[model samples]
Target: MLGGLHFWFEIRIFMHFIKKRRNKPLYKKFLPLRKNVQNRNKLLWFRKKKWQKFQRAFSRLKKKKLHDPKSYFLSTFKNFFSRKFKYNLQNKQRLSLFYGGFRKKYLKRVVKSTLKEFKSLNKHVTVLFIEKLETRLDTALYRTHFSYSFKNARQLISHKKVYVNNKVVQHNSYLLKKGDVITLDKDVFNFVILNILDSEMWPIPPKHFYVNYKTLQILVIEDIHYTNCLMYYPFWIDFNSFLKFYER
Candidate 1:
């Protein structure tokens, strides 16, 4: 009788599961589920790519600050708190408070004082401070096609495929002035500039700039030492040494 009762309970549970599964459509129960998994995996990949991009951009900003400590720190703090206060409030009332027409008046006073100090430094200091940063790696990544990650930009440069103004530059720290030109290796040629030109779902390109498909050229930097070395020893050296070694 005990064994019979157990068998009946098992049958009941199996029926319940069948009922539950039956409520879902056949397509969802089978094929759609696989497609859902595939979509999820694709999303995960894009998220990872975005995260790596953010990390690289942040690191590049940090390096710029280190290069010019006083200006960088002052600008950073000013931007940080200023943006924080701006976002902290809302609408016209928020704007009034930020601009000193509101009760606190403290925010307006701070802003004015900061501006005054900034102006006292130089007549064009404010303009310079607000100007967009033009880091070498950023220029390369923006102009020529290179690595997807900022950290990867430095690595790509080390590979000796990145050129700035007709010179093969391998330093991410190299700051760029206006009118700089960047080129990529033939291997990464398509990677640097391939854009989606379709009406399909995945329409967004990996980066901000548009790719000129017709003008795109595949030209690898041939007879390169680092490329050969890396091909042979993928995991043999540290990143810094590897950069220096290939720099030769």
Candidate 2:
């Protein structure tokens, strides 16, 4: 009788284990629901945090003289327009000066037309323009120290010593794209290796261009970062002014 009872207990335990295993699929179905609820809660938490930050900023603004809603709104509007106008004037002057002599009447029209075209082509005109300027074959060669100066870079290109994507390109103004490979002619490559490599006058390549000193090759990795580009040519253009001008 004891053996039979033992056998019956074993059967009961086996059945319990089977039932628990059967319930696992049902439990797994609810697991996704739990995870989704958790994700929603996290999103709500982030939104709440952002709203609180905005409220704090608004309160700080209120602590300033902008206590009344009408006054606050008016002051904000005035500040915005003032900043915008300043930016527009700066870019108009800079670009006008760059293209040619700065004539207020002529430059105004040029700025207006350029802004329209930029708006159609890209959302960030300043970035696009800087990218165009920095990625030219001559500019890249100069930055890579393959040429002593931008003028030298242009000369090298004009001599048919620069190859882009394995095709000889004599144009110094050829724009480079990401992953475009630039190779120098054998004579130029040898000259750079002997005369320019490790020389005191060798320039450090900008962050956007990758140089292979061993192979005398340059790869355009990406467009230069706006901040870094500014550091390199601060006087060339003012980005804030450009934005303001373009928006207007």
Candidate 3:
């Protein structure tokens, strides 16, 4: 029951952030649920992936069964959302938000922004768009194994422990640019070294970041230009469809 509550709390926060991206401040401390949080098992998150998957799949399957699609399970195996291309666009938008940690408004904004910046899609703007997301502080931290999870990375940033270019930036959405250097507060840096550095989480940091475990620092090497960014998630979503989702 406690594990269930924690999982829901995280989902709630994610959904809330997307809905009120700029309108509202986050309720990091909850008056109503503070009691539950106080007793939460810190280790429960280690198994959270399995737990979340089970709950989400079971609930979604139950709903699908109740709705009774025309083709039933066939619809799932092959384009369950719809046969139309529009469904692909929607799915890509959703997956990009869910996996990339983008808000709805921000997701569309990113799409439009990238379109204008590149001035066309011929530059493989989809890859560039994904590159932007990966450069976000929280996502970069998670990728580099600086933090155990995205939420953890966000918490560290919000606590003013993470620094970029020698300045503390609380927003996890802060974008890292080429030549920007990242470091953590001394106490937090030592703590990370004591725990995370030796954890074999990611044995090798990707080439795009110059990580010095000894210095407790990370430097943006060059803007990564990898198309395989989408492969990071277990599921499939087409970036091309995401691009098409925008009005041509």
CA deviation > 4 Å runs, candidate 3 = 1-81, 85-90, 93-101, 120-122, 194-204, 227-231, 246-248
Tens-digit lDDT string for candidate 3 (1-248): 99999999999999988997654222222121111111122322335554553333333333223222121121232564465554554454445433434566777787888888777555667777887677889877876777765777888899999989989899887889999999989878766775565455433455678888788889998877664454443333467777667534
Tell me which residue pairs clash in candidate 3. none
Index of the highest-TM-score prediction? 3
Per-residue lDDT over 1-248 for candidate 2, one digit per residue giving the tens place of the 0 to 100 score: 99999999999999999998773422123121111110111222334553554333333332223212122111122577786654455445444433222356644454465476785774466666666656778777766767655656777889889899999998765779889999989977776775465444322468877788888888888766756655443133455555454444
Ranking by TM-score: 3, 2, 1
TM-score: the better of candidates 2 and 3: 3
Per-prediction tally of clashes: 1, 0, 0
lDDT of 1 by residue, 104-124 (tens): 343344344435666565533
* TM-score: model 2 vs. ground truth: 0.49
- The lDDT for every candidate, in the order shown, is 0.37, 0.57, 0.61
Scanning candidate 1 in windows of ten residues, the lowest lDDT window is 32-41
Pick the lDDT winner.
Answer: 3
